[model samples]
Target: MKKFFTSLQTKLVISFLLLILVITGGTFLITNTQSKKALLDSTRDDMLQTVALVSTQFTAADLQTLSGFKAGDDGSPAYLSMIRRLRDMRSLSPNMVNFYIMSIAGNNISFVVDDAVSGPALVGDVYTDPDPRLFDAVAAPSVSDNFYTDAWGTFISAYAPLKDANGNTAFVVGGDMDASQVITRQNFIGTTIYYIMAGAILFAGFMIAIFSVTIIKDIKKLDKTADEISKGNTKVSVDVHRSDEIGDLADSFGRMVASLKIMMDMDEQPGDK
Candidate 1:
């Protein structure tokens, strides 16, 4: 076993195999990380686009519709019908969990929820715990902001404030859409593909190194050495028998033995150390 390990063929095979393993492992890690980043980036872009589309639908004219229902001056079946219609519009988008319109002037908010757990019961409630940024957005008459919450399966919550016909910040029309599944699935697929490719490359490299070093190269060297030995040189130097280091050492020992034999045959005196 020790001799086998010291042979050039064995050393070459081991070194090649180790190199292949490292390269393959590194490739897998890099691909995996890149894939994850790409997927998340894609999800973020999609969410952004969706939010922009939803916000665009909230205009000054739309705020007028909500304002009528908020003030008792326009309390009628038509106003109720309009609110229901707005809620229906919010529900039309499958990605959206809920849509809300907040009245910054009245400090009142109304919401329509598609998620059963966080449904419309929370609608028509006032927000006393006001965020200054949120208020500013509603005041801007077209303020858009993005928010995230892990509680509702990690959604990108967005709001775009709209002004009334009088150019006053009257309301914000915004919605929350779930991103957990979309983002998570992307991550999973990217990770899986990265690992698969990595494993395949590692396996292929290992096979190539093993076959080339231990089998192909070693066999060629062995055949060359055999031909040299067959030339019938007695007291052959093992070094000249092959091009490997092992062959060189063996040849040196062979030459030494040959010299010793010739000296003994000559009846040399034992004065030589």
Candidate 2:
């Protein structure tokens, strides 16, 4: 076992493996990073477009009615209608986890209508410490740059304003997607990269092993033939059959052996030939 590990073949195999690891690992990392960014950017655009499309379904009057209600009024007919409408709209896009409206008043953002369908937030509930991006959304459609943390944990989101009759911003409609979706996909990309890396290393090791063994085996044969010649044996032949450097060395050694036999014949006396 020790002899095998210390052999030239093993050393060459290890060297090639290291090179393959560095090159394949670098490319895998770069690809993983780019794939993650592209997935997030694409998801952000899709979510933004989702919220934008959903915003068009609501008029300012729908939000205007719900904007005045308090916590206990969450079960009101108008609010329930809004909830049903939001849920129906949400069903069309399963990736969208939730849809709601937040009325923007200076720095104060309050929930007007949210269709969570479970433990829903009440009307007129103030959003605690809202992200400043929500305010920007009141002017134009805007989305979070990536998955971001809020009172509800991390999620990718987009927001667009619902316009009133006077063309003023009534409320900002928002859409949400679970952060786990992005995480799951990123994990997938990393996993794929690792698989490819493993396969690449194995292939490199296999090829290097074949090459190293071929050269070493030929050299060993040459060494054995030389030892036989040193002991005065001239009938043994250098039997290597390759076209590479080792083949050339074998050819040269064979010629030397042949010339030695010719010289030995010439040196013989008539009776000693």
Candidate 3:
């Protein structure tokens, strides 16, 4: 086996196989990344469009209409009612985890959860100045925005600026879905491709090993003949009949042994006669 590996032809075959595997692995990784990115981007767009439609029902102008609402009140009836409305809209989409309406000036967060697992601990939380990055990016433009953050445990969030009838940005509307959703899908795909490629490599290696063994056995015969000739036995002949390079090598070795045998015979005949 070691001798076979030392052969130039065997080394070339091994290198070619390795190169193929490297190229295939890189292509798989690139394909996985592109597919995952496209899926996440499409989901983000759909979520933002849903938020826009739902916002139509709960406009910035309607904030004043929500009665009995105080600026600093927590769990107030008006606030709870708005949260319930937000939760109802989110229930329509399984992918939507939670949505929040944040007051730009007061910095109060009013959130609604489709499920208790979604945002139970953050329903009526108030931050003095909630994560300035979120405020700056989410509230700057009226256009929908997307961002990723680990502050709230790795979430992919989309924000849309809300404008009242007076054409002023009152609060920022934001929604968060888990980032791991996309990654999970990618992992599954990668695992599947890995198994498939591994199987292919194993099959190809088995075939190559079988053929290499046959070639190596023939070469070993040639080595045996050379050992015999070196020990003063020059009558042994190689029986290789193939047209390959290994066969040509064996034929040349056989011809050299025949020539040596003739010379030995001529020297012995002179002494006997």
Candidate 4:
């Protein structure tokens, strides 16, 4: 086991594998973080802008009517108008889930009107689970810093204040959109990193195997030539063909063989005399 680990082939392969892993892992982490931030920032900005524009189309009277929060209020012109606008706004993009109005009463936030017809929450219902940002949004436009989940699955939301006759914030216009695409993109990136790491390991292993084998074969040739020359046979050639360090060593070995043959021949001529 110790010899196996100490072998040149094993050392070369292990060292290269570690280097590749570090490089690939670092690159993947950076790409993942940057991609998420870019996607989130771009999406959040768009959502905030869209909701902010929608707020301008309505007046204080339009907002005040939705406050009645009764079954009768649901039939009012302002309520119907809000629902129609919510659906129309949502229709602008397939990824849009819903558009709604949430009333801010002090620090408490609740639903007043929603484009969604069913079950997550309905008109006049206070959010049992709310993102704290909703309270801050009462003052101005704001967006979720990241994806959040509730009964409606995952979404990135934005809110903009709707002003009253006195120019005070009367309500908040909110938007919800699908987050699956971004999540899927991140997942795809993660999978791609695994594939890259695997490919790097395999490629490095193959190259290291070839490199170590070539070096060892050249060194063995020199060793064999040395042994034969020590037994008075200097005719054998060193047959290594490389342009690297191994080739230089082979050239040196070949010169030593030629010098040995000359010395042996000179000695033989003196004996012949």
Candidate 5:
């Protein structure tokens, strides 16, 4: 077993195989990481664009009027108008999971216009416990990057503040996209990368097998020639002709065989002339 491993053919094959594995593994890791980042960035950009489009549909006055009304007071003009807008926005894109308007006051949040028809909050119902990230979104000059989870599930949210005539934020418009979609996309990319890497490894293995066979064939020929030379046959010749290290070894062996043949012929002569 030790001899087998020490053979030139085995060493050559193993060296190439290890090299291929290292290269393929490193490439796979780099490609997988970059792909995940690109996909996530693309998803976030799409979310931002969707939020921008939705926010454009409402004016500051519309948001101000809606903020003055309570959640359950759907009969009010502002309330009804905002609900209609939310429904329209929801229908505009299938990816838009939730759309609503919110009012933020010093870490406290109150729902002004929630799309939930059956069990929506009342206008005065305030949520004192708010994620700090949510405050960052409310304070952001434009759309903010934030993620949150609630009864609906995990979501990547984009917030756009609605400003009154005096340039103060009257209310905030928010759009949510299910975080599961991003996760699913990432998983798909990972699977694809795995498949590609598997194919590449198999191809490298096949090529290496062919290369090892050629090298081993030449080495066996040299070995057989040497064995015949050991049995008193000095006329054996190694036919391998190349410029590589193996070729150089074959050339040296051929020269030694020739020298031995000359010495034998001289010894067979009658005597030293």
Candidate 6:
């Protein structure tokens, strides 16, 4: 056991294994972090694009009329038509959770148009959330950074502005996507990366084990040759053909044996002695 541990083959295998571990660990960490960031950023950009597309479906007049919409008045032709248009826009993307139009009056914001099924805020209900960023959506060039949560679920939201004929902001069109989907996708990617790293480590270990066996076999052959030469069997020759350090050692060993044989021959000659 002690000889096995001190063997060159064992040392080489251990060194390679440690190197693979370090490199694999570092690569997995970097790749996992970057992949998560990239995935979330892609999702955010898609949500923003959805907001922009949904905003275009409604004209300034449509937004202006919907701002005064009252709850329980779903029978109104204009309200029904607006809901149909919003649903159509929502259908374009499977990731979209909800699409709606909101009006900001002073510090108060109210829902203008929304699908009937997921209605939390009535048409005229005042939003009392402490977040002041909701008001910024009135003229927001792109999506709002602030997320929203309610009884329905947590969401990442985006908002775009609707402008009247006079270029005055009329309403803000917004869309929501489930935040859980992003989290789930990130988890899935991280797990896949971990598995790949683990597989690489295992394969490296297997190859190292195989290589160690071959090297140890060559070393044993050299040891046996040395044993034979020590016992005065100087005719024994090591047949190592590799072009490595082991091969060099074998060549040197062969030369020493040849020299020992010449010395023994010279001593046996009566005149030379």
Please tell me which predicted candidate would have the highest lDDT against the true structure.
2
User: Would you list the C-alpha lDDT of every candidate in the order shown?
Assistant: 0.55, 0.83, 0.63, 0.78, 0.75, 0.77
Rank ordering of all candidates by TM-score, starting from the highest: 2, 4, 5, 6, 3, 1
Q: Tens digit of lDDT per residue, candidate 3, span 184-205?
A: 7667877877787788777876
Instruction: Tell me the tens digit of each residue's lDDT in model 2 across 125-243.
Output: 88886656778898899888877787776788889989888878888998888899888988898898889888877888888888888898898888898888788776888899989
Q: Order the numbered candidates by lDDT, best leading.
A: 2, 4, 6, 5, 3, 1
Tell me how candidate 6 scores on lDDT: 0.77
Query: Listing every candidate in turn, what is its Cα RMSD in Å to the true structure after a full C-alpha superposition?
Result: 7.9, 2.6, 5.1, 3.0, 3.4, 3.5
- Tens-place lDDT per residue, model 1, 62-180, is 56555555334223665555456556665666666665556555544444222233433333555554333455456432222333443334455555556555765566665555566
How far in Å is the alpha carbon of 72 misplaced in model 3? 7.5
lDDT of 2: 0.83
Candidate 6, poorest ten consecutive residues by summed lDDT: 125-134
Q: For residues 169-231, what per-residue lDDT tens digits would candidate 5 score against the true structure?
A: 777777767788877888899889989999999999999989788778887888888888788
Q: What local lDDT does model 1 show for residue 214? A: 47
Candidate 2's TM-score: 0.88
> Where is model 5 more than 4 Å wrong at Cα?
74-80, 116-132, 141-148, 233-236, 239-245, 265-273
lDDT of 2 at 43: 88
- After aligning candidate 6 to the native by TM-score, how far in Å is the CA of 17 from where it should be? 1.7
Per candidate, the number of residue pairs that clash is 4, 0, 0, 0, 2, 0
lDDT, residue 103, candidate 1? 56
* Backbone-clash count (model 5): 2
lDDT of candidate 4 over 104-194, digit per residue (tens): 8886777888778666356677776676677777788988888888777788888889888887887888888778976776677667766
